[model samples]
Each structure stands twice: as structure tokens, then as C-alpha cells.
Target chain A: MDTLTTPQVINSEYLLKHWQGHRNLTRKVIDAFPENHFFEFTIGGMRTAAQLTAEILAMGAPALKSIVDRSEEPFSENRFNLETKAEYLTKWDESTAAINANWEELSAQDFHETFNLFGLYNFPVIQNIQYFIDNEIHHRGQMFVYLRALGITPPFFWER
Target chain B: MDTLTTPQVINSEYLLKHWQGHRNLTRKVIDAFPENHFFEFTIGGMRTAAQLTAEILAMGAPALKSIVDRSEEPFSENRFNLETKAEYLTKWDESTAAINANWEELSAQDFHETFNLFGLYNFPVIQNIQYFIDNEIHHRGQMFVYLRALGITPPFFWER
Candidate 1:
């Protein structure tokens, strides 16, 4: 009778688009910070927005690579020479491209396969991918506050 | 020759647990702020944590019920008599229970189905669910910055 209803969660294509959309907004967030404040400012003992961004990049770039490479390792807080704001942007852009390319290497079924992230929290690939997105949104939320405290207008959440 | 690989995302049970883990961490973020600061503080022009929490609840509680009812509506930023911190927490707990009950009414196929979220974004049920999670992480990130600015210690992100 073929009475079983079809599965309805967004397809893999929508997932990629949605993720990239969020990434685009994050880039705008990176651009909103002032040069000096990006690296030096700290409120309430948290890492500088630059440092947080680096932490995100550290996880994002490597995590996707690990998924494709079938290898897992510990998450690092910083990567390479991001001493300057411009340098950070460069790294962000590089990571963005790397994400898209590596993203293509994943098959729909691969998303359901389990990959032990950071040698812990062994969840499905979809959950792991959401972790990457969730981490970015979380860090960007901090940057939104940083931008506001600096008397700058952070982009809207809906903008993502 | 069953070549179609199995989907690996944690089923609804794990999804609920994962969401609650993050919610528990967010609740701690709420507790870290002082009585007065909980409602009044803002960084970089973003909504205060209380307001952000309201937004999450506004979407979460209704969205689930709508999913169960197969209806869609625009999202609001505030709900109920969340005038005080305690009230907000209570509302959050209420929403949590509502989410669990409504979640049960949905089938696994519903996760893949598209519902015009907020009469705006038309993504799948899974993306919408992720949005609920991502939004919490995002707002909590801002709260982390706010807590730091106020000289209060925020909870660790990994605790989730």
C-alpha cells in the first residue's frame, strides 16, 4: 500500500546552505570588531573575541578535515599566526573555503555515521556537524556583546 | 545488496537529552548574574539575557505545539509574566515540559518534514530543531560576555 509517509527533515543540500548562511553572518561579525579591540579587550574574564574566533576556527577547520580524513584529535584553542585582525580574517576566509570543500566530501549517509569527535562524545555525524554550527553561533553571540559594548552595532541574529 | 547506509543521528530520545544538557548550562548562566543585573544588563546593543531567553521560549513552546498540530506561526520575543528572573526560569521550565510532551506527538518522519518556521524561514523540521538549539547557544554566548563584563563567572561551555 506504500502507506509509510516520507521522511521530512531538510535534505543534505539544505543543511549545507543553512550552515553556510550562518558562516556568512559570522564573517560579518568578525568584520564588525575594531582592530585593537578584537585582540585586547576582555570582559568578565572571557577570552578576547579574537581568541574565541580562533578557538572556533581551530575546531571548525580541523573537525571537518577529521570527518573526511577519518581521523580524530583534541581541539586546539588557537591555530597559526592570527596576530593581526587582518590575519584573523585571512584565516577565517581560508577556513571558510576549506569548510565548503571538505563539506562536499561528505555523503548523505556519511552524516549518519558515527565519528568520535575529539576522541570523546561519540555521536552521529549530524550531531557532530551541529556541534560545529552550535559552537560558531555561541562564539558569535559573545562577539555580538563585544561589539555592543564597544558602542558598535553588531549585526542582527536574523541576518543569519 | 543493501547499499543504503543507515542514518546515524541520535534519535528523538538523545535529541531531547542533548537539548536539556544545553538548557541546564543556560540555566546556570542565568543564575550567575546578580538580581538586578539579570534584567538590566546589555552588551553591544543585543537583547539582555533575559530578553534572549524570552525569545527562545517564545519560539520553543509554541513551535513544538504547532508541529504537533501541523500549524506554523510567526515567532515572538517574549511570553507570559516573565517580569522577574524567577518568573523567567519558571517559564523556561514550563516550556521544557511542553517541549517534551509535544515532541512525543511527532513521528520520526516529522523531523524531515518542512514547516514554514515563523512564517519566515521554510526549512525542514530538523533545521528548525537545530535552530532552537543554536539560538540557545548563541544567546548564552552573549550572556557569557555579559557575565564577564559584570565581573561574574560564567559556566564552562563544555559542561553542555
Candidate 2:
């Protein structure tokens, strides 16, 4: 009798779904900001929400592609010179599709395998993926404060 | 030939470990703040880092205890009136131990079960757990900016 009692809780598909949920909420945060404020607003010397979004856009699909291809590309947030809020949203949608495409290429075992993210931090691929999600949540949290200070109500955090 | 090819990428133990890593990093963010600034610092009308820490402290173990005991406790951050940074750290350590204690009471199946967290936000137990982690990362991100503004180098985000 093989005595492993617990069922598997999270698979690759579930992880993608979890991440996409956060991405969706983040999109709403981008939409909530005024057109000018998205790029120009800064509080307490932090980067504007648009700049932070640019960093997030730089990560997801590119990191997944690196992990999938075993490529050693250095990290850069300047791949797209997005200026307008609409342009940012377009890039965001493009990245979302790209993430889905790249996600399909990952095997389950690949998650446990280590990948040097952006030729920089060498951690398990799963941690790298989690970092992508965590970093977004971190920035979104700042954006939430930004929204609040701007007298705009951001989306409910739990909705994600 | 049953053809489910992917293995489980995350289990309850892994989830706990992941959350604990973020918690550990967050502890460092708290420690990085100056004694007077921890409670007093604010930017762009945001709450002080101390108040944000209060929210993180209020959630973790208490939420787990709610899930374990099947209680509908309304959320409150006033359980401990931590006046100093040291007191907050002490409470954080206590909560860390308490989170472990409450975690032991949760069976693997409990992660999928839905619990109305804090008499609000009816989400799966797993999501609630993620929220605890996400919420901390969010606040820590703010603290990071606060630290940077005050000319202090916070811990590297990737170290978690």
C-alpha cells in the first residue's frame, strides 16, 4: 500500500490561472488611473505606476520565454517605449497573450528545475514565476495607494 | 493509459514555505525602517508603515485560526496596540509561531474549502492564504519606497 494521503493541490495550469487573475486585477488598476496621472504621478519618490507597469510588462512573457527556451537574455524594461495609457494597455494585452502562449510550453518538472532569471537571480523556476506574480502584487499595492491618494477608488484587492 | 502528464507543482507544505519566505523578507523590511520613522513616516497621504504593519500583523495567524476553528471573526487590527518597533517585531514573531500552530490544524483538503475571511471576502482558503502573502508584499513594497526616500537600502526583493 503506497501511503501518500494528500492529493496534489496546484498544477501548472492552476498556477497560470492564479497569475492571470492577478494580471487581470492589475489591468483594472491601470485603467483606474487618469491618463496623465498614470505616467506622471509619483508619491514619496517612488516610480510612477506607468513605469512600474513597464517593469511588469518586461518580465512576464520575456521570463517565460527565457525559461522555455533556456536562453540567457539580460533583463530590460525598455523593450517597448510605451508613452500613452492606451499604448500601455495594448502592450499589456499583448503580454497577456504572449504569457499564455509561453505557458503552454512549460512541463511540470520544469517548474522544479532552476532557471537563472534574466541571467541574474538563479532560483527554482517556480520561485521565479512566483516572483513575477509577487512583484506585480507589490507594485499594484503601491498603485492602490496612488489611486487612493488621487481620490479614486481602486478595485477591491480580494476580487483577484 | 491514463494520460495526465503534469505533476503537482505546489502542495500545502510548499505553499506554507513560499508564504513564510515572503514573511521573512517582510520582517527585514520592518527592521530596515528607522525607529522614529517606522510609525511616523508617510508620503502622498498614505498610512504610516507602522499602520500598514499593523494590518499585516492582524491578518496571518488570526485568519488561519479562523479557518481552523470555523469561526466568523470580524477583522480587527487593534488586538495589539504595539507602540514601538520592538513591540511590533515581538508580535510578529508571536504571529509567526501562531501561524505555524494554526497551519498544523489544517488538513490538505482545507486549502480548497471556501472560508469567509474576517466575516468578509468569501474566497477559497488557498486564496486567503495567498492574500495574506500578497498583502504583505504590497505593504513591504511601500515600505521599500519609504526606506529609499529616507536614504536607507532595504533588503533585496529577490532574496525572498
Candidate 3:
């Protein structure tokens, strides 16, 4: 077992906390959405946040599981199936749990190894992991703006 | 120079390219915003992309310079002063160049070292760097929704 396999470039624990913090913040944004708007509210031609949440759920656990199993599944957009906002949250929790379970299997060294993410882009494991976080954060930002548009006060950004 | 001051966790080269890539992508998003709505468009009371862009510029170059120079400046919201969309773009370019200049002074160890960001949060350099990227990505996502609301096609996310 080589020590460099788990490089200390970014502390592994910090990475875990960082991703989870963003997740927590995102969940709050979801909670703030009015039920009526969850499925129907959309800006421009973008997918509603419900659809976007589906996309996040599709990407998060599935992507991490793929990384842990050393599998490169083809990329796919999440299809909206849930009828209620609660159903979406239920799925989100399941995915979060899955990420936790799979995260334990990812050694620090794995973060440095290059892997094809969903058989789409080939980049180092760390960058691939970042893509997951970045994508979610991006969507979450949109959710925040949505809340404001609906005359809602969303949680502070740094709360997570 | 002791190498302890420049540990190699993540490749430094990759970090530079990653941040710069996001910046380029963000710039394109700015270009996509219509002049009339650049300052006026607001979703749910959220700041328009133009205002958000100003916040990014304030944080980007200014934050990095503080890190390199070891100063602790308080975080301030971006003030809306530009009368035209072109002025906002010019300021953004200036900030981008400043980030490039300041980035060189940050060594790998700096990523691990802790400093108070904007005199608020105290975290390692890497986390702070991640903050910069994450915040911009999040805002950019909002901008995407805004563009979509306006029936404009934002540049692809991965194009950066």
C-alpha cells in the first residue's frame, strides 16, 4: 500500500464535509420551494428544479457507486417520475445515504487516479468528484434565486 | 526552500487550469445576458446576473490578492454602479487578470494552510479556493435559469 495513493493535497475528511455541507444547503433550498412551483416553476426553458433535483439524484449516488465499483456507466439524464415534492425528497435522502456508503470505499489515492465519469469525460478521480459537487451547487444556486422570485427567504449560503 | 512549504496533494497545474476554465465559462454567461435585463432581471428577489457578476469580481481578484498578500479584508457586497453592460464586462476582465497574477504566489502548501477569508471564515487555502469556484458556479447556474427565462441559450456548462 503506497502512502501517496492517498495524497494529502486536500484532506479526505475536508472533502467529505465540504460535499455534505453543500448537500445540506441544497436540501434546505428544496424545502423552501412552494409545492405548486416545485414541478411547474421554471425560468426560461430550463428544467424545473424538481427535474433538476432528479438530475442531481441521478448523478450523485449513481456516480459515486460507479466510481467505487470501478464501473463506467453511460451518462443519462434523470427522468421525472415522482408526482409529489415529498417523493423527490425521499429519493434525495436515499441517494445521500448511498453516497455515504460508497464514499468509505474511496481511498485517498482513488481521488488522484483518472477515471472515465459515466463513460463521458476522462479526468482524475478528484476532478470527477468535484464535477458532482459543482453541478449540484450550480443547480442549488438556481433554486435560491427561484425562492427569492417566489417571495421566500432562503437559508443563508454559508449555513452549510 | 523547504518542500514542506509546497506539498503536492493535487497537481498545481490542474488547479490553475480548473479555476481558469470556470472563469472563461462564466465570462461567456455574462456575454449571453441581454443588456436591458443585465441589471434589472431578478428572480424571486435574487440579485440579477449583472449584480451577481459584480459580486464575483469583488470576491475573485480581491480575495486571491488577500490570500497572497496575507491580508484579511472584510467581505463586501458588490455595489451596482455601472450604467451599461459593457462596463460590467470590463471590470470582470480586470478581475480575471488580477486572479492570474495572484495565483502564481499560491504554493501547494498554501492550499493546506489556514487563513481567515474576508475576515470571516477561517479554513485552509484549498477550501477557500473551492469556495471561490463553488460560489461562481452556483451564481452561474442562476444566470442560466435567468437566460432561459429570457429565451436565451446559455453556453454549454462544460464548454469552459
Ranked candidates (lDDT, high to low): 2, 3, 1
Stretches off by above 4 angstroms in model 3 are A1-7, B1-9, B78-83
For model 2 the TM-score comes to 0.89
Which candidate's lDDT is highest?
2
Model 3, span A68-158: residue lDDT tens: 8889888677544777889888887887788888888887668778888888879888888878888898889888877777788989887
lDDT tens digits by residue: candidate 2, A54-90? 9999998888999999997999997889989999999
**RMSD of candidates 1 onward, in order:** 4.2, 3.2, 3.6
Model 2 CA lDDT for position B35: 93
lDDT score for residue A66 of model 1: 86
Q: Model 2, stretches more than 4 Å misplaced?
A: A1-6, A149-151, B1-6
How far residue B62's Cα lies from its native spot in candidate 2, in Å, is 1.2
Model 3 residue B98 CA deviation in Å: 1.8
Q: Write the per-residue lDDT of candidate 1 for residues B67-105, one digit (tens) a residue.
A: 778776666676464888888888878877888888888
How accurate locally, in lDDT, is each candidate?
Answer: 0.77, 0.85, 0.80
CAPRI class assigned to model 1: acceptable
Candidate 2 C-alpha lDDT tens digits along B33-145: 98999989887777899999999998888889999998989999877899999999999999989998888888767777888888897977877887788889888887887
lDDT of 1 by residue, A2-103 (tens): 111233234455667778889889989988988999988877777888888888888887888988888878766765757888888888889889988998
- At residue B106, what lDDT does model 3 achieve? 81
> What is the TM-score (0 to 1) of candidate 1?
0.84
B36-123 per-residue lDDT for model 3 (tens digits): 8988987776787878888888788888998998899887766446667899788778877888888888876677789998898799
